[model samples]
Target chain A: MNLYANDMLGEPIGLLLSLLIGAAFGFWLERAGFGSSRKLTAIFYLRDFAVLKVMFSAMVTAALGLQLLAVTGRIDLAALYVPESIVWPQLVGGLLFGVGFVAGGWCPGTAAVGLASGKLDALVFLIGAGAGSLAFAPLQPRLADFLHAGACSVGSLPGQLGISGPVGALALAAIALAAFVGATAVERIMAKRIAR
Target chain B: MQRPYWNPYVAGIGLGLTLLLSYVVLGTGLGASGGITRIAATAAHAVAPAAIEENAYLGGYFAEGRPLAYYLVTMLAGVLLGGFGSAFAAKRVAIGVERGPSAPASLRLLFALVGGGLAGLGARFALGCTSGQALSGGAMLQTGSFVFTGACFAAAFAFAPLVRKEWR
Candidate 1:
């Protein structure tokens, strides 16, 4: 059975693996409280740290994991897709997305999970996101230009910052560990205020 | 146990492994908005199949038949189901609007709809949202992803208080 190596249709074994991975991926997202819109959006209110906690934790974990695997010669790192740097559009879009996130109480991903968790507002959010996409169809040309602006897809942190990926990953991990500590402190302060 | 959310660090490790599994098996990272775009394609086709035939963005997604039938849609279905499955397992599922006690329910819904609309539109414009850009791309060390994460938090913090009336 030919595995999904770079593009063409993956073999049946590869396909099944995809589903399994997806199931686990989905399961973990749910277990993290990401399926709840309230929990997911709590970061906006500084009421909960799950979004930042889970997200950064996940990022560091994956970065380190992939780095290790690549270093060990287990997986072909070149085959994986690294998102290109389109600074301006993503920056602006992220800002808009963040506002939408706080306003709607869900991100596109969590919104789906929220719907599954029986939140009607999640369904509304999903429809709203879909409509939002349709709304932008009229502005295609402008969006396209902005999307591909400064399209640099080069890989590795060392090249970008003159440091190895491992070094970068370690730095990120340290930051995450610090954040975890800080978040607990914030939660305690919040709990005290609430208790008072 | 109680409330059933795995430890954030533990769950995050699990999620990272899931992403790594996807990469090893499927050769691509995780994504969410891509699934919604597929749904949009199916809808656009239903209204007028030919109109999409000439469009650039929508056209590429249209396959020989059944553009919506694919990996992203299936994975997304799993996301929803998995969420419900976890909520049920944790006994967290409930019916009611979640909002600050002082706010009117109608106002919350209004803002929710508008906020969701903007998020949807922004995802399309930027070609991603938090999942695709912040989480997935962050894992990959993408500069844009990091930038997006920074922008998102800054914007939300700046705007959250301005609209504090809805929640407070």
Candidate 2:
């Protein structure tokens, strides 16, 4: 049985493993230049598509890989945790996150990377996020209903569309490929305009 | 001189693999905001343990023992170490503020604080941030994640023009 499914590993060991995983995650993010707020914020300007390209590619890869493993009986998809689908909260929260992304030039993860790379602004951003989180704790009681709004059965695209998981994965991969092509085209045009 | 970053696609694949490993091994995906939120809880506990224990959000963290004992908190520490290692190897570690030439440093810092606060609140509302919800949930084909992803990019693009000066 897998560690996650059977509780083969204890909490201390599990947390230790997280360090290695988190390290790899951080390394790749830094290698992608996510440590630089300027590079990350460039996506909003349409001058750089690294954010889109990286995120979409990663999503497609993980989606396809997980489905493949599931289909092959190598892993149990059911055992993996999936976040609940709260539509209204997620949608509105996403909008707010996007605005903050453009304004702060960093998200929670990348901000950590940025701070590691000695970015003072990242430090300030972290502080603000901490403070905001503290503020949220108190406000959570009042916003409980709104946060739970649009509660639905945990949903997946494949399950909702009446398609197989592999098919859904393929569809997402196709979309990602098309988006990459389109994003590159837009970046080229934008760069040319700036040059002129 | 500093080294250039890897190709976006290559880095993307690496990130995807890392995420997959997390799922297979831990039954959960990567996260960041959870750790940060815990820090806030930890601080609140120090000030008013009873009050923190009574709160809905912060209370859950305390229920699990120490607020900082969660997996995400340890992972975040690793993120810091790994990020520093990579940046140091590439000679990219330097203390500075990154902003467009047209934007003043003070304005940029102020925006960062406000924007960070908004993002923190948003993450709480959604129960996840970009990494936890958008990336991880999207891979699982979760419908709300897609909605979150679509709404996020749409809103960002819509408001981008107003904040163009800050970045451009």
Candidate 3:
């Protein structure tokens, strides 16, 4: 049994580990210039693609690495907790989140980084987010059923497609590669247009 | 004098490795909204313990006594410290609002607040945010995460023009 699966690590130790990992995550985010709302919102304006590049590359890397570990019997993929699928709520949430991202210029994670960088807007965003989350408690009663709509037993792409995890990971990596190439081309064209 | 940001691919790899480390060590993934929501719940509980306890959503977090004792809260503290350390070292810290030249400071702040509220609400509905659901679950090849991600980008692209003034 692994640390989380068997509760091998006590809660205190687990929490400590999370802190270290979170530090690393924040370090990379700041290094990527995600601490700047300008840099982040540029993706929406089509002036920059760093957000997509960083996110997709990270996704591909983690996916490939996890799949490799699972194949080698180093980690139990089945024992790991995966987020559940709630199709309609997630879809609607995604749309609202997108609009908010463009309007606010930062997501919850990035806003924290932005706040650290001393952006007052980020602070306001955090307060707003907190209030919004609190608001959910009241709305939860009305939206419980809808929020859990389209809940499915098979959650993963590989599970849904009946493909192996490694195969699915490989496909995702290939797609990320293509997107990187296409993103570069688009940035070039958009830059030229702006220059002209 | 601001230092140039790291190459996106390099940073991405670092982030991916960090995420992989989380899974290997903790059997879970990175998240931010959880921390935020927990803070909110804790605050609410302080003022209205009974009300929060009676609420279905807020009560779930309080069931554990201290809502801020969760992993996400600790991680969030790390995020703040790490972010501050990186920015301080790089001299990227500045006290001001960020907005396009064409946009007024007041307008930008308003947008930030409104947009943040929408995002927070959406994250609650979706059960996660970009980091937790999209990136982590996407790496796990979760079907709904991919769908949520696709919908986010599609909607962002579709609605970006409406908010073009804020960013441009």
lDDT of 3 by residue, A19-100 (tens): 8888888889999999999899898778899999999999999999999999999999988877898899999988988888
What TM-score would every model get versus the actual structure? 0.92, 0.97, 0.97
lDDT (C-alpha, whole model) for all candidates: 0.75, 0.88, 0.89
Off by over 4 Å in 1: A1-4, A9-18, A153-156, B1-4
lDDT (10s digit) by residue, model 2, range B1-168 = 999999999999999999999898888888898889998788878999998898876787888676776788888898998999999999999999988889999999998998899888888777788889999999999998898888878888888898888888
- Model 1: per-residue Cα lDDT over B1-168, one tens digit each: 338678988888888878777766677777777777779767877898887766776776775675755566666766766777777888877765666768787877777788888888777766677877787788777788888889888888888886676665
Task: Kindly report which residue stretches of model 3 are placed more than 4 angstroms away from their true locations once superposed.
Answer: A7-10
Clash pairs of candidate 1? A129-B120, A158-A163
Best by the lDDT measure: 3
Error of 2 at B86 (Å): 0.9
lDDT of 1 by residue, A66-143 (tens): 788878888776777656678887777888888998888888778777777777777778887877876777678666
What's every prediction's RMSD, in angstroms?
2.4, 1.4, 1.3
Better of 2 and 3 by DockQ: 3
TM-score-sorted candidate list, best first: 3, 2, 1
